[model samples]
Target: MTTISKTRIDGMPIGLTLALLLACAVNLAVLARWL
Candidate 1:
């Protein structure tokens, strides 16, 4: 996980990127339940 994250653009804040990833996971979970 650490290695993959290291390759991201340095212009973006890590915290914001992590939040987006978390939000995506939450959305996927919600959709999975409905399906």
Candidate 2:
């Protein structure tokens, strides 16, 4: 996942970047809620 994200970061489209950011934000939010 890290490898793919890194590559996406390097050459992926802005849409993908936004999607990745959104995914991270959702993950963090879920973790925060759980904790």
Candidate 3:
């Protein structure tokens, strides 16, 4: 997720960045649960 981080550093809005991070975390959690 270097691209995401770069975008965040490049001044992407905080809300959108937080949403993306939250979504990623949720997705990983779901996958871990399923596996």
Predicted model with the maximum TM-score:
2
lDDT by residue (1-35, candidate 1, tens digit) is: 77666676355788988898899999999999999
Q: Residues 1-35, candidate 3: write the lDDT tens digits.
A: 99986976669777877888899999999999999
Model 1 misplacement above 4 A: 1-9
TM-score of 2: 0.72
Clashes in candidate 1: how many? 0
lDDT of each: 0.82, 0.91, 0.87
Order by lDDT, highest first: 2, 3, 1
Per residue, candidate 2 scores C-alpha lDDT tens digits across 3-34 of: 98688698988898899899999999999999
TM-score of every model?
0.69, 0.72, 0.71
Candidate 1: the clashing residue pairs are none
Stronger candidate by TM-score (1 vs 2): 2
Ranking by TM-score: 2, 3, 1
| Best-matching candidate per lDDT | 2
